[model samples]
Target: MKRNSRLSLALHALSHMAFNTDQPHTSADIAAHAGTNPVVVRRVLGKLREAGLLTSERGHSGGWRLARAPRDITLADVYLALEESLVASPSETEQDMCSVEHALAIRVSTIMNDVEASLIERLSRTTIADVRHAAQ
Candidate 1:
């Protein structure tokens, strides 16, 4: 399934932080590395911050750092923090007239939910540190 770049970006930034735990990374720095806008980076990282995965500081020398150790953060954590589902489920608003379409949509939605649950379970098995180690 095709997923949004936000998850990729989040994982990338976290992997960098995993290597350099002592230093903070700015949104601009991460954006440059990911080849995206700083604003987009901020928006993505902002969600991480709210989820307690990362912490942000203000001022010239200030930036973002991991709130928890890389080993303590799972891929599932990042995925859930971003709050975007990889599975394309049926829309909530359905056409009431078509019973066949409605039944199909319900079944598909149930299957998608199951797929998402499986995805989360699999992701929870791998931590950000695991990803960093794999990259090395």
Candidate 2:
């Protein structure tokens, strides 16, 4: 499966917030840093807020801040908050019953499952703290 840019952007935002814990960041600021639209940043941050990873405020002093410490937030946390399917595979929509295609489908499913497991496992090991430090 292809890497989702949305997921990467969410991670970047979270890492930025973690690294700058003393101050809140606006969507516009994050958008500029990530080189994306503010609306996209806001929507992604909204989901992160819902996942208890970040918090947002309104009004003149309104912005976003990390809900917890950088070490407390994992890449898996962001991925889960975004509700993304880590791995997507082709569905056997076409008829393959009683044919070699059936075996191919099973093999594909098994391979995809393995890949998904590895990906999630690796992602879980890296926290926002890790990204923040690495970016420095």
> Model 2, which residues run further than 4 Å from truth?
1-4, 94-98
The lDDT of each candidate is 0.92, 0.86
User: What is the RMSD, in Å, between candidate 1 and the native fold over all Cα?
Assistant: 1.7
Cα deviation at 106, candidate 2, in Å, is 2.1
Compared with the true structure, what per-residue lDDT tens digits does model 2 show for residues 5-124? 889889888887887898889999999998989999999889999999999998788899999899999898888889877688767665745567787777898999898778878889
What is candidate 2's TM-score against the reference?
0.87
Error of 1 at 52 (Å): 0.3
Off by over 4 Å in 1: 1-4, 95-97
Worst 10 residues of 2 by lDDT: 90-99
